[model samples]
Structures are given as C-alpha cells and as structure tokens.
Target: MKLPYLPQDYSKKEHIIILSILLLFAFTAFLLTIISTTGSTSDYVPLTNIYLGTADITHINVTKVVPQIGPILAILGTALTAPNRTLDNIFDSLKTISETPALVPLMYLLSNAQNVSQSLISLTQLAPLAISGNPATDTKDLVEISGLLKVSSNESQTLNGLKNLVVPMLQSTNTSNKEDRTTELTLDLLADSKDPLTVAKSLTVLNNLTMEEKMKMIPIFTLFGVTKNITSLIGSLETIVSKGDAISPARSELMLTTLQTMLASNPNVTMAFGTISSLASGDDEKAAIGAIQTMLEDSNNVNTTLSSLSTLIKSNVTQAESSKTSLVALSSIIQNVNDQSKAVTTIAQLASNTDTATTTAQLSALTEMLKATEKGTETINILSQLQTSLNPNSTTFKYIPSLFTLLDASADPPVSFSSLVTLTAWAQQNPQTFIPIMGILSDALAVKMVSEDQLTEMTPTLLEYLRIPVYFQLSIFTLCKRNLEKDILECSASHAVQNLDFRQIIYDALSASEFAPYLNALNIGPNDLYLEGDLLNREHEYVPSIKAVLAMNILGIVFAFVVMINIGFLFWMKWSSKSYAWVIVIFLSSCTALFLGLSCTVLTVVLQVIKSGTYKDAFGVVFTTGVAYSAMMWCSFSLMVISSVVLLWVGITERHLRIPYLMKKNPATIEDLENSSTEADNAIQETKHEATPGQIIRHSTDNSSDFLKNDPDEKQDAVPDIQQTNTSDSS
Candidate 1:
C-alpha cells in the first residue's frame, strides 16, 4: 500500500539491522527467563518485584501468545520500504510489546505516564470542586487520589506526579471565588506519602479561617472551642507523627490557635502561664513580640488580633485626666520593630481614640516615632489598615474619631499635623456608619498655603485628591496611589475622594514600592451607590468647629462626585482632540461614569458627546448625574468634536482632518501633472492654431495670448501681438 509521506534514506539494510536487534533482544530476554527459571541467580531480575496483578501462569501464557504473533514486529520499520508490513498487525505488535521482559521498565514508565494524563482530567474536574464550601467536598474528588495510589503500579512511579499537582490548584483558588485548591491536592497526597507533614498541612488548611476554609475550620475550631473534637484531631495527628513536640508545620498553626483559644476559654495552669509570661517578658522587644508581631502582621489575623489587643490593652490600662499618654511611647519599640499593618492599625485605633489627656501624650510619642524612626514598617501597616478601616458598619468606627480628633484645633498643643494629614485622608475615604467628622470638614474650608506645601512628599499633581471638596471624601489622583503612605492618604480620603483603584491597578502596582503592603489584604474599593447601603446617610456637611465633615459618609459621596467630574473632563478632552487614542479615553470614561452612576453632571457631558458627535455640543449635556455613564460618553464626544472644530476655525489645527478623496484625486503639483503627461501633451496640441483645409498659420495668437496671461504685467508688451496665419507652404 502506498502512503502519503515516506522516509527516503531507509532501506533493506536498516530493516535487517532492526530485525537483528529485535531478535537479539528477544533471544536474550528468552535466555534470561530460561536461566531465571532454571537457577537461583541473584541478578536474574532487572526490575523490582513490582509484579502486575496477574500470576506467573499468566506471564507464561502471554509469552506463548507473543511468539504466535511475532511477525507483526516487522511493521516497526519504515512502512513504505516495507509496504507489505502493516498496522493491520498492530494488535499482535502490542501483544509483543507487552510480553517483552527487557522492556518491562519502559512499559511501566509509560503506564505511569498514562496515569498522570488521567490525573490531568481528574484535576480539571477537581479545580472547581476543591473550592466547595468545605474541604471535604474538594477532598472527595478522589480520581486524582486514586491515580496517585496506583493500585496497578507502585515501585516505578515516584511521588513527583502527586507533589506538583497541588501548586496550580493552590494558585487558582486565590481570587474572589475563594477556592482552596491546595487543600484538595494536599488531601489526595495523604494516601501516597503517608508523611505527617503532608497530613498536617492539609489539616491546617482545613482549619484555616478564610471564608473558603472557615466552613471547614469553623466546625472543627468551634468544636475544639466548645468540645473535644480538636483534641481528637490533635491526638490522631500526634499518633501519626509519633513525635511529642515536633509536630508538622500545618499542625503547629492549628495548635497555636488552640492555645489562644484555650487561654481565652480556660485559664492555663500556673506553670503554663509562667512559661508564657517568661516568653513575653524579654527586655529585648524583638524577642518579646516576634511571634505575636508575625501573627498580627498577617491580613488574615488583623481583625482577630486587633480585637484581642483592644481587649488586652483596655483590661490592663486605664487613662487618667491631665496625664500624658504613654501608649505610643511604651509601644514605640514594638511598633518600630514590626511591619504588620494590622498590628499598626490595632495600635493606632487604640492610641488615637484615647481621651483628651492620653491623646496628647500618645499623639506626641507616635508623631516622634513616625518622624525620627527609620522603621516605617509599622506606620505603613497601620496607615494601610486605617486606610481600609473606614467600614461604615464598624462598631468603633475608628476613621471618624481619629480624623476628627486630628482636625480638633482646640486640643492643646496640636499633634503632628503632617502624619495626621495622611490619616485624615484615609478617614475621608472610608466614612464610618455613624458619626460625622466635623473637624476634617472645617479643615477643608480653611485650607492654608503651608498644608498644600506639605503635599510635596507625595506627588500632589497626580493625587490632588482633595479637589473634590467633600467634607468626608478626600479627592486624590490615580498617580498618588503608588506607595503605602500615599495609598493610605488615598484610602483615607476615599469618602471625599471618589476614584477607587481597580484590582488591576493594585496587581500592577504590587511590584511598586508604595502599594506592595496591600497585596495580601482585602481592601475593596467602593463605587456608585458606592454604598448599596440602606441609605446610611443622605446629607454631606463640613463642620467649621472641628474643620471636618460632620458625616464622613457624605464626604465619600462627594469624593465620588469629583471623580465623576474628572472622568468627564478627561473624556471631553480626548473627544475634542479627535484622537484615535479615544479607545483608552473611552475606557477611562466608562470606569469613571460607572463609578459616578447617573448622579453626576459629568454624565450629561458624556451623553452629549455620544449624541452630538461634536465636542463643542457636550456642554449642553452637562446635567446632574443620574447613573448614566453611556450618556456621559456621548456628551464627552460632543465636547471633543466641538473643541476640535473651534481649534480648526482658529487655525490651530495641528491634527487636521483633510478631505479623504481630495488628496488622492487632485493633481496638486507638477509631478502630478507629469504623471498625466499624455493628457497634457494632447491638450497642448489641441489648443494650437487651427490649420484649416485651405489656410495654414506658422505663428499662433492663441499660444502668445496664453503665454502673456502667465507672464509678468510689466513685461507684457516685450513681445508684439502676433496675428494668426495658416500659410504653412509660404512660410
């Protein structure tokens, strides 16, 4: 049979060589089997004793059947040169491949590879499954686990196949979906490795407090908290490891939580308390706070640790009137040593909200620390948290109190105004559910030159966030969100400053110096209706007494308004310029309008741009926003077109719109005329003096008149006016 493609070089020589090799392999393999059956030789077997499920009788039968079908091996060579050999014998050849004892290891290798391929599909089904409400659901996806155990083949397959399957699964789970794919992969590996570390990591993941893991952990941890189930899991884990104190990494974390829980619920024995107190008592603050600091630093632990710290601090200390606060001063070493934002937030909330006497004292210590201390790790963390702590529903509502306190002009010996500036910006962004920050409101009304000058540290040109003029909301540009200090500044003023950084911005900026701290936290930006709240607050106001917005929520709303205006302005500019780059402008306008909703006048401009197509006409569209971003886009288009037209009329058209076909069709230059030289020559001859049948002219008046028309008027009489004659023969 002829084939579509054939190998050129292959010939009978190659076939003979292959046959010789195959015969040699088969003959040697047969000889080895004979010897192994005959004598008790130590080197009889190349592969380990990983025999398949069939007994030795089946192996003998497979061997007999292979020779009966041995002729099929001929097709393993080039099919064209050996056309008589065909895949019709593919089944028989497969039987030979199966029976070849020398190829046992390779056959095992491929079979294991095939299992890996099957695992790929199993993992596909497992991906979404792993993210199920509990780890159990993801864990039950046993297809991959079954593949890993390999009841069919054991010695040849390494743990490599199972080990790597979890990494991607772990990474894929990291999103709004809150999927914990890692836990599923880890659970599958338990059957293969049987290593305590593997089981421990899986257990710890199951017990994690994330929304995904919480359902699993909540039952376990709560059970641990209330009953003895956690103890059972712990005891089972201890028995598996057979080690008393050196538990696996996963189990250690669970144990820590268990310890914390036990401490809260059941007071520890005197000896145990003494041991912990000793650990906490180190004069070396680094050593004293390392463990607690690490836990507090994690975004996962921030809320938990903050609540714990607040409870701890309140229980241990009391404020006195006419006393200088010692909180920041006492904790400066701790704060300066750690870079945990949650810890910083925990400290800041407590430190900033102290009564009048303590506020002054604590404020001084914190201010001095921020100024002189090179360790801004804590400040960045705290600032980042304070930036996000603007949850309208928070019980303490730290943003309003801290900001208003900073804005309080009447407080004796004002604290560091610069540090508070950034903090105030954050509070403005996240308005509390209750209480208006009147102090910050008044400060907006009384903006001084010095305060504006202070904005030089962060790029004020980009952030110029407060331009929105909201009492609570602080307006900032997208550029200022480059760093923690600036981000906090931006986050603080979010109530007043409407533009929220998209996740893409954070994803891109994660590598940048400023916003790197935010990669691990959940700092969601609010947009239009921005609060789909039960109408938490409807009015916005700035209080002169405190120099801040009375209702920080209103400030956030105003910030959103200004953001709408900025978006509208940008779109309008792009539309007016008649730039093809309007695609990007379109995107910016969309995001802004979407954020602004139909409540801003910017939407009117945007809509007019879309409808009128003339940028000049967008001004008419400038109506109060009513949640219509599409309208805003049209308005922007109108403004852009109108502006472009005005610029053209004023002779400022650098980017001019030339008539499309006119340039292509019109002969504007001598080169163009020369291109139509035949037409030019024919026309020239036709206009010459007419030599009628009876008369001929040697000189032509038509040529002379045409030349005179083009000649200078001063030289018009240089040539005499010639009379036309058609007497060619006489001439």
Candidate 2:
C-alpha cells in the first residue's frame, strides 16, 4: 500500500525571516503578558492598562514598573491611539490575550483605586462592588496596602471572586441609581458578614435577582446590616424565650451546638434560617428547622428504594395490560390480608418444604399468572404473606402456591375475590355441585383449560351450569361420544369430533362422573384423558395400517370378481373342445382363491389382535366381531376353493366326454360334420349318371361284346360298337 503524501507549504527565504520576526514579537508580547499578570499590584495594573487602552501616561512611570515597559508602551500606545476608544472595542481587541490567574487581583485593586475610576470604569462598574469598595476595601487595603497585607490576605481571594461575579450582573441590569445604592448596601453588609464563602454565594444569589426582587430584599438587608441595638435584641430574645416552649437544658445545648457546627460547615443553612425568618414568623422558622433537623437525623433509604421500585413497575407495563383484572384482584387480596407477615412466612414455608420439581412447577405457574395479570408485585406479596399460614407437609399447601397463582389470573372480580362463590344460589343448596364446580374452576385456571377471554365470558354460565344439580358436562362429552362405536379406521375418519376436546373439558370441570359411562363404553380411562399436552400434538385421527388393511380387502374382492368373470368366460368359450382350458381355468381359480384367502387372512389377524386388546375405544365392535367375521371369511375361502375345483372338474369332464361322430350321425350330438356327410350322400346319388370317359368306354366295350355273342348276324352293330369305342377313345 502506498503511504499518504502530505502537501507542504513552501515559504521564500524572505517570507520565512518575516514569519520568524513576527513570531519573535508574539513571544515577547506573551512574556510581557505573563509578567504583567504576576508582578506587584501597581506594576500589573499599569501594564494591563497599557494593553487595554486605559493607560494614562501622565500618572504612571513605565520604567518603574518594568525595564521593558518602553517597548510595550510604544506598541500598545500606537495601537490605542489609532482608533476611537470604547470599552467594547478595546475589550474586543484585547480578547486574543489569554487570561491569567493574576488578572483577578490586579483588576480588584484597580477597581478600588481612587481618581482612576475613568481608566478602570468597567472593572467595578457594578453597584454591589462599587458600594462595597470603600469600607470593605478599606479593611482589606489597610492590611494589604496601608498596613501589613497579612490580616485579611487569607480572605482576599474569595472576596475578589465575589466582586467579579457581581460586576457583570450589575452592569447588565438597567437599574436606577437608587436601586444601585440598595444593591451596594446589600453587598456591603454581606462582605462584613462572618463567613466570606457563604456571603459570596448568597451575594451571587442576590445579584442574579431581578430589579423587583432586589427591591424586595433591600429593606431586609438594611436591617441585617445596620441593626446593632443590644437592648432591642435582648427584648426580642426575651419575647422569643417567653413564647417558646421550654425544653431540657441538655437538649437545648446539644441542638444549639449542632446548629452552630452546621452553620460553620454550610453557612447556607444560616441564610436559609434568615430567609425563612424574613418570609414568616420566628416560630415558623423554628418549626421548619425542626423538620429539617428531623429529616437529617432519619436514616431510611426511601428515595433510593422508591427509585428502584418505580423502575421495576415501569418495566412491567406490558405484562400488566394482559392480566389487568387478575392483578387488581391480587392487589386487593394482598392488601386485605389480616396478618401479612405471618401469611408471607407460611407461603415461604410452603415453597421450601415442597419437592424441587413441584416448587419449579409452582414458580412457573406463578410466573405465568404474573404475566397474565401484570400483578407480579401483588402476587409476590400475597405469596409471601400466605407463607406463614401454609403447612409445609400438608397436601393442600403443596398446591397452595399453584392455586393462588391461578386465582391471580381470574378475570371476574366477584369470582376472583371469593373463589368459592358460585354463579347461582343452587350451588349453595347442593354442596356437592359446589365442590366439583370449584374444582373445575381451579383446574381450568391451573391447567389453562380455557383462554382468559373465554374464561371471562363463560365463567358465569359455567358456574350456573355447575350449580344446576345436573350432569352439565355430559352435554359436552356427548359431542365426542359419537366416535365410541367406530373402529380405528372409522374413528380416524370421524376424528374431527375430537376437536371439541370434551374429555379435557370434563377433566377440567372435575365432573367426570357424568362422563364415566362413556369412558367405560369407549374402554378409555381417566389416565388416558390428556390434561397437559397439546391436542394438536397428538395423533387423534387415522391409523395407517388399518387403512392399508381396508384397501387390501377392497382390492382383493375386486380382483376376485374379475378372476371369476375370466374363468366363467374361459369355461363358456372352450369347455368341451379345449383340454388346456381346464389349465387356464385352474390358474385363474387359484389366483382368485389366493386373493380372497390372503385378504381374509389379513383381516382375521388384524381383527383378532385388535379385538384381543383394549382397542374398543378406537375400533369398537368393528374389530371385536373378529370371531364371527373370521368364520365368515373362512367359509368364503372354502367356497372359493370348492368353486375352483368344480370349474376344474367341469373343464376336465367336458373335454373327455366330447367325441367326434364318424360312420353314422350320433343322435346325441348336434354337429356340422354329420350334416355335411348327409349332404355328400345326396350329391353322390345325383351325380351317379355322370360317368367318366374310361367308365363309358369300358361299358360300351362290354355291351358290344354281349351283342356279338347274342347275335352273330349283327356285324354292323359290332362295327358300330368298335366305331363308338374309337370315337370315345379320340374324345
């Protein structure tokens, strides 16, 4: 990677020299500024005056202040004379000069100097500082300027800073000279006050006051500054002492010592006393001080504790929104507890004594209830109070936490506050209904059997139904009972009925007595009723094997029917003529037997296994009829075998009995060959006179011989015979 290149400024040699000279001048001025800040009071102020354009050459000797004053005066004098001088403009030009720590004291000194007011007009232009300058500065100047500077030198820094703070405020406010006099008087009194730091802070507070507020405090400060009558003070103290209630001397002394010490440390407290006194009566001030003293003496960390609690409450807003009703009930329950501490101890015992698993479950239940109600604090308080009343080893106590957690989630206030209260008076009449009904509610809440909105909507109706002294839950259960008679396959087809979850609802209602008959009828027990798991997570519908078995049976019947048809056709087409037709018939018959037999076998095994077990709930009478069905299937198989054998025998018998008629027509047979032979005989008779040439010649020769033997004188006849023979031979 290439390095970044920096552009450099190139200066000519002459420019560099000029730059160096200018730098040298700046450095000299900076050194002079430092000297001017730290030197003697006269030396510092007069030198600052030069740069500030306030220097009067006639009054000050520059060389006396510093040997380099000539150069400084020369530069500053030229700059000062070049423009019309105004405090704002002069200050603007001098803004580049860095402020030094020593400037405060030098300015304080100049502001107090006599006859140099015009030169240092802005330094102490404030009424507060200007009025305090004479007497207050007299005391300081006597030590630092007129006499030894040691007496008040320790207090000078604080006093000077106070003066600096007041100057800007006094200058900024457009107040009349009368208001200025009053402000100056207030400052004069404050400067003379005991603690300078406290006085300075108080004076700052007073300096920031508006013209109206200053006018308000002037008369108060006037008495505070000039009130020096010992007799008057004695009378006022006497009046207070007489009017005030007496306390033990010990307490009085102790309180006085505490107040005195506090005054030294935080003199603002004394100002507070003065302010309160001015605003009210002395008695009121005493009462206010007592309150403050009591507050100081108290050690509770209420502020810190409340802050944390407030933060926790704010963080639980979302949770509270969901379970508003429950939280409200919990809060009331907590507040209404007679012995909160004892209850809390009992609840604690309940948790500690329970099994770890049970405890975890209870805690989870509590947490959910808290989320639902947004009443965590109230639930916690109730649980804490209930702790002392709970028996660790008691079974009832084991569910107490879970029960309370559930109750905390109740939506209806009437029911929540008094959980045992029913929707109707009938529950009061029959305690049994009440018992089961209450159990139902508890279970419903504990297991989340219903949603909050649902519980809210149905609480009254369900409560009434429960108290009606009837089997209300059976109504719901009957909706699911339609599947009781169905086999696994049938049940799966009708599985949508399970969506009602009547079983779970009955379980939640704690009224399973009504549903017991259905349970037994279906051959399912209470343990099979799922109370915890999700219904959707279960396979409530189809059994793949049962469906496959049903398909197989259907396919077998169809195949058997097709094979029987084919066999019948074969027997009909070639039964008597084709010998091998029996073979095809047997093959087809065997195939039909196999299909039927296999289907029956599968059905028998499956039905038997299902019937032998507790599958009545799933398969009902469908599988339970295995014995009868098996027998029927076996009979079917036998029938199929018998039919196939009969077909085979028929084919074989027909082939053997069938014979071709030869010599004479067999009356038993109706064949085309016999009819063809009869027709051939008739043809022979019709063509008997139609002889061939050889037969005709031979017949003529025989006839001619007989004529010659029978009549010798017939030589012409003989010749005719010969000539006929010759003509026949030629033809």
Candidate 3:
C-alpha cells in the first residue's frame, strides 16, 4: 500500500527510501523529546513525559536482566571510540554537529546511550551480594564493581547517578531501606575487608563523592567503626614504611586524608587532637605530619596543632633525626604556620643534637627547617646556634656546597642575603674549609643580578667578600663574561645589559679608592672601566636601528596600491573588448604580481633570520619579521593567484569566441564593408545575366587578379595565367 503523502506511481525503491527518511525523522523527534524532557522536569510535555516513562521502564527492565549493564555500556562506549580518540576529535565532532543545520536535531542523541541512572540503581541493589561475608568469593567482584564506579564517576551524568543512588542511602536513617542497606554493606566492606586493594578502592570511591556527600558519610563511617579501620590501614602503611618495602605513596596519602576528612568533619576536638597526636609518633610519621598540616590550616586548631607537633618532636628526636621524608614534610608544614617560634625552637633542638651516626640526617633536616623558616632574628639566632653546634671539622660540612647554592637568584632575597652574610663570616674565620666554595659563591653572585630588584642589595656584600682574594675577583669576572655571552643570545640587548650589570657593578666598586690597593695590585685602572662601559653601550645603539627597520610599514602601503591596481585591471578586463590578447595580459600580470609578492614575503623572512643570526652574540639583538607586513604580502599574493586562475578558466572556456575589434575597428566600418561586398556580388550577378557566360568568367578573373595583386609574387603569377588564357582563346 502507498503512504498517504507518496504518489501511487512511486517505485518500490522510492517507497523504501521515503519510508526510511520518515523513520529517521521520527526517531530524531523522539530523541529531542527525551532530551527536552530529561533536561527539565517542570517543562516536560505530557507526550514527552509518557515517552520518557516508557523509555525508563524499558531501561530498568534491560538493566535488571543484563545485571550491571551501566558498566557494560561505559566499557562498550570507551572501546568503540578509544582507538584514536582525543579531546580534539571529540570537540571537532561536537562542533561539526552543532554547526550543521541537518545534524542539530541529532545532537541530543550522542549521550542517549549514556543515560544510565536506571542501570546504576540496579547496580546499587547488587552491592550487598558482591560485599557478602565471604571475602574469597566476593572480593574480586566488589573490587571490580567499585573500580567501575570510580571510572564512571568522571562523567557528570554518571556522577549524578551515583550521587542520587548513594547520597540518599547515606542520609537515610532507616535500616530497612535497600539503599541504606547498600551503604551499610559498603561501610562494612571498608571496615572488615582484609585486602588493602579492596579498602583502597572503597576509599577512592568515597573520596570521589562531593564534599556534602562525604560530610554525610562521615558520621555513618564513624558509627560503623570505619575510622578505626582507616587508622589501622595507616598503621599497616607505616609498617610497610619501616620495613623499607615500596608502598604506594598515593595509598598512604589517601588513608591519611580519609582519616583527616572523617575527624575534621567531626565536632569533637578532643578526639581529633588525640587521634592526630597518637599517629604523630607512629612508624608512618609522614601521615601524622599531613594530618597536623591539615589541622593547622584551620585557625581554631593552630595552638593545639602546634602544641601536639612540638610535643611529638621534643619526645621523638631520634625519629625526626633519621627520616628525611618526615623532616621535609615537617618543614613544609611549618612554612606557612602563623606562630613559628615553637616550631623553630623544637626543630632547632633537633638540629643542636649531633651524633656521628645521625649527623647527616640531622644536618639535612636542619637545612630544610632553616630554608622553610622566615628570615628574621629567629633565623639569625638559629643560625648562630647551628654555627656553634656543628663541628668545624665534622663530615657534615660536606653540605657546605648545598648551603652555598641557596644564594641562587630564584631564592628569597632575605634568605639569600642571610646565607651570604653567614657564609662570608665562615669564610673569614675558616678560609681553608670555605675557600673551596668561593668559586661557587662567585658564580652564583654573577648570575644574581638577573633576578628582581630585591637581590641588588646583595651587590655590596658580594663585592666586598670577593675583594678579599684577587683570584675570587677574577673568577667572578670570568663567570660574568661567560654569562654575558649566553644571556645576550637569549634576550634583547637592553635586557641583557640589565641582567649582566653585575659585571659593571663589580667594575665600579673596584674603581673606588677603598679598593685602590686591590685594583693597583691587579694593574687595573680607569681605562679598563671605560672600555667595559663602551662595550656595553655600543650594543644599545643597534636597538634603535633594529626597531626602525621592524617598524617600516611600506609593505602594507605597497600591497594596498597593488590591490587597487588589480581591482582597476579587473574592471578594465571585464568592460573592454574580450579577446585572447586581453586574457593573456591579465593572466601574465596576475602571475607576475603573485610571484613578486611571494618573493617579497620570503625575502622579508630571510632578512629576519639573517639579522637574528648575525647579531645573536654579545650584542644580543633579536630581529623578528613584522606579522602585519607578512600577512599583507601573503594576502596580496593569494588574491593574484585567484585572479590568475579565473583568467585561465575564462580563456579556456571562451576559446571559440571571435576576437571582434582587434585593434581599433568599429561596428560602422564593418557594416559598410558588408554592404560593399553584397553590392559587388550583385554587380557580378548582373554581369553574368547581361553578357555572355565568358563575361562572368572575366569578372571573376578580374576579382581574383585584384586579390592576387595585393602580393607582388602572386601578381606576377596571375598575369602570366591571364595571358595564357587569352592566347588559348585566340587559338
């Protein structure tokens, strides 16, 4: 039977195609209904609501029969698109679908298969069976399902589904609700599961929930004894740490963070403080350090937190002295603490205790603490005590190079200054031990001028310290020269000078009367200083010229003029006579202009490269091609190329057309010539009728003779032929 809109004359193929199109349109409409209804509950059309209700029922039935089809759908979706999928590809596909008018209706269908709320509800129901009392049989299934939940949580839709399924369960106080039962099963798995992998997976899933959801689960977790389970997990990690076995740092951090989240959310401060302090001296002291750092973040817990930390450190010096990781974590913790006096005193006590066996760890820990501590009277006092506490001849002095490295330009100005002053005193007192590090100190000073203005204050101290030894001055100058060469190649000339001003500062300082003995000893004078200034100033002159060259806008003006000329040429070609010659002229001019524009663009780029390479030395001049000029050249060349293509197309397609008015002939002259030819033909016809047939032949012969007489050689041949015809007639 034919459809109502289709004609009766339609063939079977036509009918099939029309029906298929109709089906696609209907499907797209249904997809729109689903998306429109799902996006808002209040705006749902009655028909759309019925449609969605039917879809959700079908979805629920399929999920029940398939058992965990949500995860199956997620895996299938990933597998189908995972081969070469990238963020770029996904964005491009979405962009194309949105931009195309034909595909806009189908855009909502892309995520239709991923609407897995019903499937998630089904999976939620199955959680108890997977988390049954039998670990051997259920652990694998529980881990797999939990992992699936974790992976699916990255999608907003799946995450919403999870929130809906799990949040209500955590909020529900009823013991008989299935969702509440599911929550209980999950918490039991966390508390009683022997496999660390199972516990870690469960914690990760919980961590992936929103903060509100976590807050809701905290009390439930506490009531289920999950907090103790987490603490025990931390203990296990600490055991693994003490045994020197490689444990996942992520797992350890997760355990501690989970415990912190639980306790911090709890209103009981005594329990939180007691729990934190208990873990502070455990084998996993890093966990306690993290917990304390979290507590310190809240201003209410700062005093209690610092008190606990101070107590732990004072009681466990041996532990703090041996663990480098714990030391670094502690240093980071106290870096931002408001009250540093307690932390400093406690850490200084650890630094003051030196033993042959633990000297290295203690020195490392003290250095980290000093680095983290703000530079002030407290730091100075700490350094003075360390100066006396550390043995002058101990092997711990091996870290002097590291200590000297703290003068780096990136370091805090106050810290670098303090370090420099302290090291200078040490050098003055013990030249033998600190002498070897003077070269390192000079190298760092020469590079320090490149930092921000705060570091410039160290210039006088650095210069005074280096002036004590002539070789130190030479080492600094040499380093400054090397750095000048490297920095000049990487920056503009002015920037390079500003960065390498340390050399100039040293030169100016040495030229003073206070350093006259040192300068005279080195045979340096005003001429040396003037020569250095001249070398630095010479590169500044090149900067203005380079800027002038780059600032030239002549290329854009030329391109504009060329575009205007091409526009006029286009009009002239169109309105004037059409011919092969005109076409050739247009094509050649366009092609020539195209190549010339292209050549200019390439030449400008080459000039930029040559200039950049030529001045990439002590001059430090970097040349860049003008982007606007380059764009203009390319655009002009592209327009010419298009013109040339069009000219060629016109020439080929209209090759058969006649070239009228080749040079200067007009329509009137052509009309006059046509009339004359017609009159001449009439004259020949009249001659043919009025005279004998021979007369007609004679007239034709006369006309042929006149045509041949236009050429010299043809005229001679025609005369002989006429004479021969006359002779034959006489015979």
Candidate 3: regions farther than 4 A off: 1-574, 578-632, 641-660, 663-669, 672-731
Error of 2 at 206 (Å): 42
TM-score of each: 0.14, 0.25, 0.18
> Per-residue alpha-carbon lDDT of model 3 for 564-614, expressed as tens digits?
343344333233224545464455535444444544444454444434432
Which is the better candidate, 2 or 3, if ranked by TM-score?
Answer: 2
Tens digit of per-residue lDDT, candidate 1, span 550-624: 122223233333433433443332232233332333343333333223222332333233233211222111112
Better of 1 and 2 by lDDT: 2
Error of model 1, residue 283, in angstroms: 22
lDDT (Cα atoms) of all candidates against the true structure:
0.27, 0.31, 0.32
For TM-score, the strongest prediction is 2
Ten-residue stretch with the least lDDT total in model 3: 51-60
TM-score of 1: 0.14
TM-score quality measure for candidate 2: 0.25
lDDT, model 2, position 57: 13
Clash-forming residue pairs, model 3:
none
Ten-residue segment with the worst summed lDDT in candidate 2? Answer: 1-10
